[model samples]
Target: MQNPAIPPLASEFSDLPATASHGPLRIEYRWVNETAATAPIAVFLHEGLGSIAMWRDWPQTLCERLGMRGLVYSRPGYGLSTPREHDVKWPVDFMTAQARDILPALLDALDIGMQERTRMWVIGHSDGGSIALLYAAQHPDELAGAVAIAPHVFVEDISVESIAQTKQLYETTDLRNKLGRYHADVDSAFYGWNDIWLNPAFRTWSIVGELDTIQQPLLAVQGHDDNYGTMAQIDTIGERVPHAQLVKLDACGHSPHRDAPDALNEAIATFIKSPSKAPTSTPARSPK
Candidate 1:
């Protein structure tokens, strides 16, 4: 696909300084709150190809609504952050790398650990949703709650097929150009996510078993028309995690925050502001 001209609004976060590298990559992030207020800290994790700028003002809006602090950043290989130089693909163990290595390194670098002094709330979308799930499952003690939008608990055939189609779009259409506006180097962000999800070894991936380990409160959401994943993704989460809540929005696509911002904001604010106690059992499925 021919690259598109960078959008005028694309450089909104260009001036934000990058944090010193605690690992091989230098992390870039934007903080909405400087004061150590009583409101919980909500960390916003973008989608596979998403960056701080691509998120627009959703994080800030949510933070203001809930009177909470917001932290937004791009993953190592995406957005304005450092990119991997090799042609290596994202391995089947990508989730493990994120859960055990990248996330901790970023948190430590930012001096934001799971210590009780800081109660953290994770809001992750798409691939980020999976990362949040992994983090919450591994360190349930560190998080107050998690909200995963369009999370994939298992590698479904449909997901692989969709990714394959995306590869074709990247090659034959202007998809690359559109992505370039959100990422400094679209290829690094694109292929790092694309190649890994479509890898043959990724077919055997499943985090369903790990869901049982997540003792913290969880809100699993998906759009009825989400092209990237199906209701089964969120369903499996509720089935395995007794305390999990499921919400499906109608007329919504893969990107709920973009397609249905009002509904998404309401759902998140409600979940985040609610009492920390987990429900006795899974809430009844409410599919919009």
Candidate 2:
């Protein structure tokens, strides 16, 4: 369970206009340490079921510790953003769409200029980690670096099995009501993600072929005991992106930021401070 004692990250909503494939939506976004506007920026992309609130104080805590600004936001159909239609399902390329289009639109809307865009890093978890990778692949010139925690390069049976179990738990337990605390429309958030992952066609979904396109500094982290994914998620990425760094933590599970925040933050901080020299599995520094 997430501790409720941590203060919420301050936020503001941006009323983004309709896109070619979607309608108008409002994005719930927060800036951590706005006073450090000139400092390097790190954007926090939440997990599939996560929201700005669900991220708790990690983004702020990390940025404060690194002396960097943080941009944390909930994507459409999650958190305070617009909800998906009741009968809808996310496309197989949902993560791709988010990376290639939605993110750029929001950055433009925020007037985050080209210079800042080039200086920004992305810290992502799960599906968010995939988005960060896809974005880096398509827009390498705009990113300074990326830290992906438990990111998926390919779909796995374990991931689907866990998601299916979660579906059952949500129906039988208080998971729905619990998740409601973080989302504006819980069903939209839950079903939109669940239906697609459980979709038979999504089983072959993989972006591993495109991993070679990512030229920015990369830090990939996952736990040795991750139930939702395996070491291949990061190892294969490192294989494709030779310069990518990897950190595998012992005695940790899927949510590294929550399960091992100190180590995660330390590794990321060390990487961002001097990415070129970031160690690959170096104990003095670290991911998931």
The candidate scoring highest on lDDT is: 2
Which structure among the candidates has the greatest TM-score? Answer: 2
Q: What TM-scores do the predictions have? A: 0.86, 0.94
Global lDDT of each model? 0.77, 0.87
Question: What digit string (tens of lDDT, one per residue) describes model 1 on residues 172-270?
Answer: 999988888877678988888888888788888988888999987789889888888899999899889867877788888899888888887777777
Model 2: per-residue Cα lDDT at residue 220 = 93
Looking at model 2, residue 97 earns an lDDT score of 91
lDDT of 2 by residue, 1-288 (tens): 222432344568898788786789888898888899799889898999998989888888999999999989999998877788888778999999999888888899889888998999988999999999998999999999899999999999999999999999999999999998888788889999999999999999999998999999999999877889999899999899999998887767889888888888888888888888978665322232
- Per-residue lDDT value at 120 in model 2: 92
